[model samples]
Target: MKLHALSPLERQDLIKQYAKSFSERAKQHDEEQSFPFENIEELKMIGYTSLSLPKTLGGQGIPLTEWLKLQELIATADGSTSLSIGWHMGIVSELNQKNWPDSVLTHVTKKISQNGFLLNTAATEPDTGSPTRGGKPTTQAKKVGSDWVLSGRKSFTSMVPALDFILVSASMDDDQVGYFLIEKGASGVRVEETWNTIAMRGTASHDLILENVKIPHDHLVELVVPGKKSPSGWLLHIPACYLGIAQAAQTEAVSFASTYSPNSLPGPIKDIPAVQSKIGENEADLIQARYLLYGVSAKWDAATDEERLEMQSELGVAKYHVVNAAQKIVDRAMRVVGAQSLFTSNPLQRYYRDVRAGLHNPPMDDRTLVLLAQSLFN
Candidate 1:
């Protein structure tokens, strides 16, 4: 079916309908640290895998804002699956927005639509940390005749096993930064199973090593001109992922509170005023976070390129409010559930771990606060 032809409400309904099965698949995937092939296949069958492809490419062309909302809904059901697929969706959406050459876009879109292909950004370097700094990439890509040879190591490549292509940021000989599309199974490219983390354990964010991997010139996306500011929307992906985690936390909290009863409590925990109050607080925080995210996203959609560049501080505010508040909301949910929240079988325990990952995401708390202060002061 042509999902792109559907109205916003229809698309939302379609996603909701599929979420039940996806949630079951996610639970299994999370426990085994396995890729959610079943869930992904379901997404492919429903045309969700090709949601971001351009209409010209024979695929649905969903807007990024709509895409983010859909992601939030899916995340509310299963965070690990959502987190895994959301990264791929974001990269695909961004590439579509870039309006690459028709041939390049068509080729990638065909792969995605037909095979449920996935792409991820491999930008995090071990030495320099987050790619937000726009630091000089330790990875180097040099012109070797017709092809560019890329040699570097990238850490925190989320959803490595499922990736079909990776956008690797590298420094050119002229000291310019550029993105190169490195295809899977490319010679000299190896994935190291190094993702040992406390949260998002199912994400498979392993380290990728490239040793003289060759990429065609057309694979290069854009050259990052020196002194140019980074785009604000790029940071939105981090918050988007966290928003999903937060919504999941809220869902689990409400479900548990409504059904679970303690020995001391007369009825379900939901009947307890204190538990109810905690649920209320968590709901309020989630609502606040959602508003901040959608509000900023609306502004972003309406913003011109220049206008968006100037709204760096506002973007930071959105990220800061949503991510930090969502963390607190999840914590409150855990408190409402009491000791049961810590059980391995309880989804709340996973929510706790997943939500904390946002703390380290870009637009770090200190940076956002500093930016806010600078915007208000001098």
Candidate 2:
């Protein structure tokens, strides 16, 4: 009956149990560009929404290593679903680690654990691109009589239609930038369907527009203080998600090689040294990527304040290497599968597309390289 306090393997097996169903319907959701609400519900029923919360709060409170491995397994089942929910998982976990206000943390943890609520932050604007680029948001929040009127358009709002709590970044009249949490059904809030893309179609990432939306004064979560940005463990969730997707691709490649046999060949291609070599290559890189993610995550979990202060670029390196290697693993799998990998119905085809999305996630490759270079001198 109890899910927490279990061995890591036991917790992973439980998470994988739900992943199977998500894997089964992945293609359908992708084809229709529909949100996998059912997949999220299953995770909710399993108490996954609270996995990162502390046990004192009636949550699972899993560590970074185990949480990431579970994320990889879930990504294996469905990358879209994994990525969509990663926002919620990462934010809750990161908030728990911070000395930030309890108003936001208590409200979020209770809603997620008790009501199965989901969270996503909307910061990207059409003109400025990724929020990590240091540009002030165009979305403006004007102070009113004990309320803030938020007006802005957030592009690439992942899990838009399904989010229970939407965190919107806005530039206040006082020239301060902060994130405001908007609950579902808020007045003057609307989602414009606009998430048509070649990859990760099931993410339901659309444009969220706020026209004079009103919220309480406390809704502004935190203001960004330049040169004082705190390091976050939640961002690691992105790399972990990609690693899971790549693992899925590897699984499909190995299974395909062991089963398919050309009439001209004596047996399955898995027997041929060439095919074996390809799978071997993927396996080796996958191991590297997996270990890198786990090792860094473990280090982060154990790091004290002084150690954490030095991890700025280390975290980016983890994301860059893992995501790039993950993309490569999926590509190698496609090579093992040959031209058939291109078929619309082939999982490898989908894997290739999905894995590429990681390249565009936060801490982009170029930025990672820049960070690495800067860290060397400092």
Candidate 3:
């Protein structure tokens, strides 16, 4: 369909078509706690996986606002799949804009375009906590003859089942933290099925066990100054996913209210003043959060590199507002649906669990608040 040539709205319509089927299958995946590999494959078939690459590199090079909108649409169908693939999308988008070597960028983007390859960074560990908190990795990487051998375990390695590449963070012999790009099927690399949370279970975010996995020296992609990461506007996809989930909850609640008639009621509960008020509040919250998210995204897409560096706090602020609003929206939706929303058959239950996962994603709420405070002082 030459998706890259389509207008943003046209492309979104195409995604909506695909997402309808995804919405149908979401229940099965959630019930089985199974990863949605088929959904990922379908997205690949339509070239959605490579949409975030630079236009000069044979991709759409979609703007941040448009990219996040597509992500939200996908999340409205299935939050776990939306989140699993969003990491690949946002990481590819972010790295392509960085100062990584030209050859490396070309190689990575080529695989994405040609093979539907996926990549994600594995940084979290039981001892070190969230990578954003600046804990040094206990995972050790030692210099072998012409390669680096990494041996350690990484927690919360999302999309591990389908990942073609994993950028692992390891502490080097020199006490430096290096991100090594390790290919799947590398010697001694194994996945331990440790992800069993009540939320986002379909992400397959298992423990990645690396036992002396060796990669070429050039594959040590980047070194980090502990506790420091450039502000990532691409992280807005996290909020976008939750917003979709919230919207899904809203839809479910409204539909349920409109049709659910009890012996005690004159008609569907949707006509009740209290139910209408809850629906109104949900809509208002969605409007507020969407404006903030898209507004920040538009500003980001139009900003130059130097200007974007100063937008870190603004980006975090958007995330904070959007995620918390999503949580509230879901809660209100459950109230609108009454006890039925908690039933295993209800999608709202899944939405409730999935939205909670957003709070634990990068750029925690506390950190966002601290950044806002420090910005005023500065």
Ranking by TM-score: 3, 2, 1
Clashes of each: 0, 0, 0
lDDT per residue for candidate 3 within 1-378, as digits (tens), equals 746668899999999999998999999998888999999998988888888877776677889899899999999999998999999988888665556567776787789888889989999999999999999999999999998899999999999999998989999988899888888899999999998899998999999999988888788888897689888888999999999999999999889999999989989999899999999999999999999999999999999999999899889989999999999999999999988888999999999999999999989999999988987898
Model 1 lDDT per residue over 270-330, tens place: 8888888888887888788878888887888788877877878877887788888878888
* Stretches of model 1 off by over 4 angstroms after superposition: 56-59, 96-103, 113-115, 225-229
Model 3 misplaced stretches (Cα beyond 4 Å):
101-103
Model 1 TM-score on a 0 to 1 scale: 0.91
Evaluation by lDDT, superior candidate among 1 and 3: 3
Question: What is the Cα root-mean-square deviation between model 2 and the actual structure?
Answer: 1.7
Residue 22 in model 3: shift from native, Å? 1.2
What lDDT would each prediction earn against the true structure? 0.79, 0.85, 0.91
Per-residue lDDT tens digits for candidate 2, residues 1-378, read 234556778888888788889999999998898999999888887778888877666577788777877888888989999898888887776665554467866887788878778888898999779877787899999999999999889998998878889889889888898888899999999999999997899899999999999999888877884234666766888899888888888888999999999999999999999888888888899888878888888988899978987777778889999999988899989999899999989988888888889989988889879878876788
How close to the true structure is residue 108 of candidate 3, measured as C-alpha lDDT? Answer: 79
